[model samples]
Structure formats: C-alpha cells, structure tokens
Target: MREVSSDCRVAWFLGLAGLIPFVAGGVIAWWGSSAWQVTAVYGFSYYSAVILSFLGGVHWGSALQVPRPDNRRRLFIAMVPSLIAWPALLFNVVTGLWVLLAGFILIGGYDLSRDGREGFPAWYFKLRGLLTGVVVAFHLIVLLRLGG
Candidate 1:
C-alpha cells in the first residue's frame, strides 16, 4: 500500500463525517417514535438525493478536465445520477427510497468502474467505494424498517 497523504486524510475525514446523517437516520428509523420515524425517514431520503446529486457533480467535474468533444458523452453520463435522484423525490416515501437506492447502486458502479482511470486518485475511488457501501447499507436498513 502507498503512504497515506494529507489529501487522503482530509477526504477520509469528510467522507466519514458525511455518513453521520445516514447513521442517525437509520438508527432513528429503527427505534424512534412514530412521528420521529417519519421525520428521520424523510430527512434520510432528502439527504440521499442531495448526496446523489453531489456524486453526479463530481463526475461533471471530471468531465470538464478533458477536451470538449471527447467529454460530451462523459458529461451526459455524469448527469445520470441527478436525473435519477430528482424524480425519486416525487414518489411515495417507500418508492422514493427504492429509487434512491438504485441511484446509489448505479453511481457506485460507475465510480468503481472508473477506478484508476480518468485521473481520479486511487484513494478517492476507494473512499467512494467505502462510503457508497455504507450509504447503501443504511438505505437497506431503513427500507427494511419501513417494510418497503
């Protein structure tokens, strides 16, 4: 393994910090009172959409780094996550969560497929994989709690 750099440290810190809400939401969904469960589930769904959009933005950033013509397809690919996330918000809570889960899985697959290519750092890709795994797990936990 390579020596961990300051960049890796910061990314890890932020990435792990980002998981806090997912953890809280999952915990509350499991044990919070009825009203609180509703709030947590909704909050979790909104947060998931935001994160999915952010992932799309990351790919957009990557696409911008290359020459214009070649990046056209990549830019379109980058938009897919946000596209998947927005319509998800319009559905019922259970269906919305299912959509969000699909978005995460698709985007996570895209990220893993790009590992070691496109100038993205290996540490960053690894961090994304770990974060995506945890996020998807939380989604599953909450979905199961909802019996969705």
Candidate 2:
C-alpha cells in the first residue's frame, strides 16, 4: 500500500471531525424527542469543538509549506482564530460559527493572496476556500433552522 500524504491524512482527519457534529446533530434532531439537553450540551458542543480544533490543525500543518521560520510563524499566528473559535463554539453555536467564519475569511484571504506564488499549491488554496464556503453555508442553514 502506498503511504498517505500528510496533507491528505490531515484533510481526512479534519473531514471526519466535521462529520461528527453533522451526524450527532442529525441523530439528536431526529430521534431524541424531548429537546435532549444532554445531547446538545455534551455531544454537540464537544463534537463541534473537536472538529474546529482539528480543522485548525489542518491549517497549521499546511503552513509548514512556507519554508522560512518567520513566514511559518506568521502563518501559525493566522491560525489562532481556529484555536479560539472552537471552544467558543462549544458554548454558543452562533458566536462560534461567527468566529469560524472570521477564521475562514482570514484563511481564504491568505490562500487567495498566495495563489500562484512559489511556496503553496494553487489548487490546495482553492480547495480550502471551497470547503470553507460549504461549511459556512451549512452552518447558516443550521442556525436558521435552529433559530440561533
């Protein structure tokens, strides 16, 4: 078997992390009849945080492509939004989603700005932007439905 690329591995992990909330939320919303406070507080919140944090790790891992220590440091600094947003999301989905949106904005901006540059692959940035857009849309739909 071929060894998996680190980036691919990271992406897969992040994707799996994201799916946890989607699945848990769907299950709770479907089967659990009585509002399911425990599911919301424990399951949803915890899964959201884990997903956000893993997504941040994906960004941090990708930043390794920037060779210079200073550049990598700057990229890491840019990743801080992911770190902050995850835990906040655990408390409040609206606020957390907003924070994540901000992080996605910053990351997307960085990706767009760096496109065609020597260090980063253009497709990777494009893919990230697309994934972020999808996540943002999903979050919006969820919020609207939940009235959050």
**Cα lDDT over the full model 1:** 0.89
Q: For candidate 2, lDDT tens digit of each residue in 1-148?
A: 9775788668656754666565556456445665673355345445545555655565566567556645666566656656766567665656765565565566556556533233555445555666667655655555554566
TM-scores for all candidates?
A: 0.92, 0.59
Poorly placed runs, candidate 1 (over 4 Å): 114-116
After TM-score superposition, the amount by which residue 116's alpha carbon in candidate 1 deviates from its true location, in angstroms, is 8.7
lDDT of each: 0.89, 0.57
- C-alpha lDDT (0 to 100) for residue 134 of candidate 1: 97
Total clashes for model 2:
0
Top TM-score hit: 1
